[model samples]
Target: MSTLTHMKPRALNLLLLLSTLPVFAQKPIIGIFESTSSGAGDNQGQPGVRVLFYQSGRQWRSYNAICQDEACLKTIVHLYPPVTTWTLFKQGKPVAKVAATTPTAYHSYSEIGVQTITNPAAVLHLERRSTPDYPDRPHAILATNLSHLTDPDNWQPAAVFPLDLTHVIQAFHKLYPHPKNCTQNTTNSPSNYHDSTYPDSQIKMDSSYLSNKTNWRMLQITLGGYLCDGPPDDAYVDHWFAISPTGEVHHLGRLMHLAGAADFAREGHSELLFQVQGGNEAGYKLFYDNFTHQAQDTVTYH
Candidate 1:
């Protein structure tokens, strides 16, 4: 009876050892080539590239290589274990080779350039191109030179005045009954130009203008003397108009204004210190009022 008890315990230990043996004996399956294609001509379209991927435990590994012909096949064979390697058969014969490094391990995959892969698990593809006229694409357009303004950061839509066209025209007519003609040049030609008798004040109007495919009924308001030699105490004003395709014109006023004083002595000549402020309707109104007051004060005092 005692001998039987000792034998039972020994038998249980032997069974446990046998159960754990399979876990370590299990080999990783490796070097499985997932995809391969034939070599086409000089290899532009198809030069023989194979992509492979495999899993070991929880981690994944991949490899990419140029497989031109049989020589490439031999190279792959050297990398993978011989007995477990499986040749990727295209049609009836082996086009490429694959093998498991161990019992369940798989090889890895990778590639260069844009390529697409589709399988039950996922689909991925990529394309490369360029866009030129994209609005957000950086470009510069100048208030004076659109081409120079090609730098996106520097370009701004032309400014408008604070007062609308109807109001601005009325104001100008009241201030200067006889409007003067503008110089015949690219920007001002065919448009009426007027200069204030006082060097510090001036106003000009352009009846026809076009921008961003829309015709503009335009106005130019200049305050402060061009000949003042230094910055003006007041600001300058700009106004814009947009005419629709139906010949309907709308006044978009007070586009921009420049203000503040210049340091004349520091730079030898009086330099205009200017600030560009506002694009919205309220902004235009504030700028127009500021410039108008400055111009009126200068006219009255000088």
Candidate 2:
């Protein structure tokens, strides 16, 4: 038998009473230290200390202990080599057995059993629950397969092509078969030829009132060459036309350039003729100044 020392009288009495409990009827008496690391100079600290209760092959026990030293704290936790049984007392009687085992030698503890659940539907539901919707919303245009241009549900008929003075004149001539040579009387040489008083006056004319000198109503046609040859994806060329009141049309001119506008308005006439090409076929308004014989302003198709 191992002799016990320094046993307090009260502790002995309590131990005797615990021995008489029903718990000791089935197993041998086991001793346990309620606290460890209490000795002098053992700066083993409280961090590595733990209280454990468990059972042996046939008895219950409990104890508290600290890791060997400060340096071995991490190693002791990793190794967990110590495992002990526990004793339980109820009303001063032993009543149950508590068993524990340390799979790791440094950190003494019993292995905990964990059950993994894998249900496809449940997992998918959980994933969907965790996912967000507002931030990940789909694009409106991407929701449908049909393009906005072709989709009848959202289709809108575009307005008819806008018509300008030049186009109106052309259309009028095309519709109403105007005589090629209209008869009209002409004066040989007007006294004030440059005077604004004779605004609509006509000069020398041939047998047919149509002056052979120069018809200011003549329309000029021009084709703009390739501005760029690539797929026209991001690039475009501006095709411009300048028509003078004298019926002389100049093509491939930049309508926006002041020089081009000057060239078109230098000739005194009733109207300034111009056209734009590239984006869409639309008519544009041309403003003319009778006094300056120049185009004052223009309103283009959007």
In candidate 1, what are the lDDT values of residues 1-302, reduced to their tens digit? 33223223433343344355454453322111222211222222211222222223333222222232332332232232223333332212233332222212112211211011122021111111113553112111001100111111111244554344445555544554533333332233334344534332255553332232222223445532333222222234454433333434443444333221211122221111122233111111111111222111000000
lDDT of 1 at 257: 30
Task: Find the candidate with the highest lDDT and give its number.
Answer: 1
Over 215-301, each residue of candidate 2 has an lDDT whose tens digit, in order, gives 322222221221222322111122233333454433322222111111111233222223322232211223234212221211111
Worst 10 residues of 2 by lDDT: 138-147
Residue 68 in model 2: lDDT: 28
User: In terms of TM-score, which candidate is strongest?
Assistant: 1
**Candidate 1 accuracy as lDDT:** 0.27
Indicate the residue-level lDDT of 8 in model 1: 30
Clashes of each: 47, 22
What C-alpha lDDT, on a 0 to 100 scale, does residue 296 get in candidate 1? 10
